[model samples]
Target: MVERVDEQDRVLAVVGRDEAVRRGWLHRIAVTVCRDREGRILVQRRSEHLARFPGHYEVASGGAVAVGESYEEAASRELAEELGVQAPVRFVVKFLNRNGLSPHWLAVHEAVLPGDPNPDPDKMMWHGWLSESELLRSMEENLFTPDSRDTLSHYFAAAERPSGQP
Candidate 1:
């Protein structure tokens, strides 16, 4: 079940994921921007079998926020599920993504994996770690997931902000 929400992200009710998709109901999603200790970002080609954004490259591992789950909890679960790693993640930003397949409030987080990720084949067909510059360059040549691209942009913007500013 997914928690349906209003434009302001206040939960309205719990509904089936499919129903939410069918009706274009707003919901919560948690995204994680993962990086290795060497500062290379992890990128993956999503499995072609997935219904949404199949075969697109993504810089993050994430999914819908399950009913009763916090954004941090969802982010942690998704990172482990898609990348096979358990690590602490920090909250980054939250914003409404109206341009995606469906509208949702996205909570973005950041994690530094302890070691190489063993990506699940069911989620991604290929995975690699790339420098920030390389990832930016590759984005121009790859069909990357739109939400991940937005997450990356917001993440970079947050990093560039002054510490005292929101």
Candidate 2:
């Protein structure tokens, strides 16, 4: 089950993930951007068997936030589940992504991987690391998941703002 949320992001109910998707209800998704010591971001191609954005490149590893789970918890879980890494993730930003394939309140987080990733074959087919500039250049090919693309832009904007400025 997923936690359904209202516009202000308060919990409305805990409903089936399918039901929330079918009804176009707002929910929570937590994605984590894993960076190496040199500041290279991990990039992954979703497995083709996946239902949404199959075979598309994504900047983060994440999924629907489970009922009763906090975004930080979900982000950490996803980072471990998808990339086989256990790392502490810090929340970076949260906002409503009403235009994505699965509209939801997205919580973006960042983590520094302790070691190289061992991606799950069922979730990711290919994974690599790229600098921010390289990722931006690759996005020009238009092969990335739409939501990840949007998240990248938001992440960049957030990083540009002064500390404590929100």
Q: TM-scores across all candidates?
A: 0.96, 0.96
Q: Write the per-residue lDDT of candidate 2 for residues 1-72, one digit (tens) a residue.
A: 999999999999999988888889999999998899999999999899998888999998898999999999
- Candidate 2: count the clashes: 0
Among the numbered candidates, top lDDT falls to 1
Candidates in order have lDDT scores of: 0.91, 0.90
> RMSD (Cα, Å) of candidate 2?
1.0
User: How many clashing pairs in candidate 1?
Assistant: 0
Model 2 misplaced regions, further than 4 Å = none
